[model samples]
Target chain A: MQREHEPNEHAHHGPDKPTYNLVFVALTVLMLLSVGTAYIELPDILHYGILLTLMSVKVGLVVAYYMHLKYDNPLFTWVFILPVLMGLAVVLSLQGLAGY
Target chain B: MNAAHTSVHGAEHGHGHSISNEQHNHMLKFGWWLYIASEVMIFSSLIAVFMLAKRLYPAEEEHLVLPLVAFNTFLLLTSSWMVVRGLVSIQRGDQVGLQRALMITVILGSIFLGIQIYEYNEFTHHGVTLTSSMYGSAFYIMTGFHGFHVFIGVLWALWAFFKALNGHYTAENNIGIELFGLYWHFVDVVWVVLFTLIYVM
Candidate 1:
């Protein structure tokens, strides 16, 4: 029983389950790194830097893989990313203006 | 969704007289992502507010239960993965698999909420009310809003699970779960940032 669909019913297929497993492992490891480094004595700049970097990587993985943006329409990337950048810009500008 | 059938013309989008199912699904996806995009603004604003408040308040250090919150984070991350698993199941036309995965996700999410409520109780006992200080107020507002989203996610997941139970989706027409998956994943992504800013940093 083949289900009937118009041509091009599915434009793309996302990562398979194994890829998801790999991503899960990577995310978990990244999180552990973030947690482990939180307790270490380090310069304020470097400590915050490391944590922010790790957090960014984790967010990228979740958005790209788990959310299937990598396989979805490119327009989706733009739609989702543009606002994120705007939000970042606002935060940065506020920080600069506030002198904190 | 392996059943064979003839093509019927037209779409519910109302832009044109007819449209393939694929077009309809794409429209749905576009609409949903647009909504998610709007949500990012509100959430990012909340994050910014908290970060700024943290700097201004300069309050005495309050020790939160790191281990407990960390465990809660693990639950949320795992539930996010579970949501994807359910989507994969539906894509493969395994309705039962999707149902079970959604159930697991729901349970994990519920547990996360329970732990958050319990932590709030503990904090309240320690005199950390919303009016305590800017730091406490920002913390409660930001995290409470996220908890509200998680609660909504749980409810949506349950609705999706029931939809699957009714065989409303098929291998080739599972935009329903797929869309839900995207929302759930976005929720998880928000938590990822929240964990870093609110807890770790």
Candidate 2:
């Protein structure tokens, strides 16, 4: 078998074309779902929940697959996720304090 | 020593390679992620402020042209996928494939930026300037920052493309391309949040 010439990170190839295609499909679906929620007349909580959940998932998919975080060392994932989570926590706390 | 460094070490444990190429690349990758983390902090702060502004002013979403922005979002998402494909191509040692993929990514990112410029023009024409209203200001700040990031990513993509054209990245030393992929995907992820908060909500 022909070996890879100069594979980066010690020749550990990340996700392939098929995985990328799958991720693309998933992102589009979640996006459409979010857009659908926007048009439909739903309860505030329900609409917010759907949109937030789908947005998070879509972001997760991009970070995990497209960013190749899932394939890399776990540190990069935490490094990327921690700040956003910390900010979310702060925002939620502030919202709670404000009686939101 | 560390799991993250294991790949670097495992490849060249005692060959002084640790002091050389592979380890250096891994460190560069990690440092780039740290930079991205800092970027996340900056964006999160802006997002918190936007949330507060949004609560006060409440965005007038009726004026938002969802179709165009939605297509733009799709364009970014697809462009991210293309970046991944480009990385995969180099991993398979196909330099031409990588160049083609980067060219695609550059095209998609450029189009996204163009649409953003057009959208800004439309919003301004419709009386939504940065200083017009609190929500308008916040909207511009958030989306403007993202647009700036996209512009940088586009320039970065062009640079990476030329590098690919010059045969800089190979299957073994393609960390530069990987780093580009990470930055591009981070831009995409940020858009996912902004699109929901600014437009859909």
Candidate 3:
């Protein structure tokens, strides 16, 4: 009964198990790429720019898929993302205030 | 002909029921996500403080060991994958698989903490203690708190593993495991930022 129940549930709501494996592979590859990027001798600003971009992508993938935010209700996304947006504002404001 | 149409309609009904169940699961996940968002606020404050201290004492970067930190990053990332695999296993009704994956995750988390202890010891040898300067304080507070979270996550995963041993979770009902994955993944995400800021930058 449980096995029968899962296919229907997954078909209705979520990705298959194979997709999770694919996502895992993608995450690992991205992690390696980020670490590799760190060693490259680009100018400081551009180097950080690439690293931050990669980091954001990794975060997005984990939150959206691994955390099921992508398939979940939009309200959950808003609930989680709003505070993060607020946090970003605080960081930026503090950076400005600190004369950075 | 009528029987064929009735069977088709029943199939649609089954799909509808499945969707409702899926939505119920999402509602539970929403509550967990809200808790995670609160966690985000806590970490954000610590991160802001760390940034301020870094600005004040820019030369503290010399005390950080980037290669070891990167290796630790790999450990956490691997553990995150294991937890996700654990969730996938339980979702498929594979109790043994779930337990195995979660056990690996716990082990990886422990090793990550061990490496952290080693790093802290190294830092102490290099004259970087919590009271050494504002930079030292911020570094310890941020990374130490993250390490604490990893500690809690390892314990949480162990509990989940035991629960799996008792067959407490099923494909239709595994909110406990799912919530654990969410928390673990959040911890990993926090480390991603902390690693970049504290070590790389």
Candidate 4:
């Protein structure tokens, strides 16, 4: 003797999953904040400092989440970041040799 | 066929299997990084030359336009976000979303290019040409090179969008999406550093 019907228990994947929309929203906020701040004048070369800091934060977000490097092996992240550090070092050395 | 020849062919296919698509994709990504390293060297030299020349001729800063470059930077930053959204859409298996994001990205990229052309126009309107002064030469060379790269990236995004419309990518097969995303982000990153170096500082 069969009844009318029964709901499929596993129709959907799961009830507990994180939404990435919040991450996008946060990134958008940071991007806008940085752009707005760029309009303000800073003392001396500190403008580069502020811009670099904000750019790093923005790049960090993109690399970690958007690039999926967060879940990737630490070694892979090292490969991507090592070039950045090296590039900066090269620039610093070149600037030093060229004087101010 | 001879047994020796058959074994040779079998070993060749076996070696091919060992490399795998993932390995090939990683190889291409690493190649991109190496290309960026070369670019870093090139820009470092350009900055060095610019600083040296600026020290010799300190009066050229009067003609530089800051606001237009800032607007161009905003255009690129927004375009970067759109590129990421496209990749994310592909990751989520949303074909329509991917197409929409890519379209927005191309539009933003075009706006950036348009701004660059306007900047060039402004330069010429004010009697600034590549042969005008050392500053003018460096300015056009550095930024013109970057603008050309942006043009290429826009075309790449358009092609990717077309392919996406034709069902080229799926959640499980989205390495192409990631590769283009990486290239797009690299272009954005280079512009970030450039805007700071060339315009702000």
lDDT of 4 at B73: 75
Candidate 2 lDDT over B1-201, as tens digits, reads 244544334554555334555567667888999999899988887887778777776645557889899999999998998888888888878899899989998899999999999998998888888998877887899899999999999999999999899999988778888888888999999999999988888
Clashing pairs in 1: A1-B2, A1-B3, A2-B2, A2-B3, A2-B4, A3-B2, A3-B3, B10-B18, B10-B19, B11-B19
Q: Mark the 10 consecutive residues where model 1 chain A has the least summed lDDT.
A: A1-10
Question: Best-fitting candidate, measured by TM-score?
Answer: 1
- Per-residue lDDT tens digits for candidate 4, residues B69-153, read 7777777767766766666566667789889978888998999999888878887877778888887787788778778888999
Q: What is the TM-score of chain A in candidate 3?
A: 0.83
Model 4, span A5-92: residue lDDT tens: 2233121111111223444555556555555555687775676677667667766766665555664445556667766777667666
* Local accuracy of candidate 2 as per-residue lDDT tens digits, A16-61: 6777898899999999998888789999999999999999999888
Off by over 4 Å in 3: A1-12, B1-24
Model 1 lDDT tens row, B18-86: 456767777888999999999899988888877887788745236567778888888888988887777
Location of the lowest summed lDDT over 10 successive residues in candidate 3 chain A: A1-10
**Model 3 lDDT at residue B127:** 88
lDDT of 3 by residue, B36-88 (tens): 88988888888888899888988877877788888888888888778777776
lDDT order of candidates, top first:
2, 1, 3, 4
Model 1: DockQ score: 0.47
- Cα deviation in Å at residue A93, candidate 3? 1.2
TM-scores, each model vs. reference: 0.89, 0.89, 0.86, 0.75
- A-chain TM-score per prediction? 0.82, 0.80, 0.83, 0.67
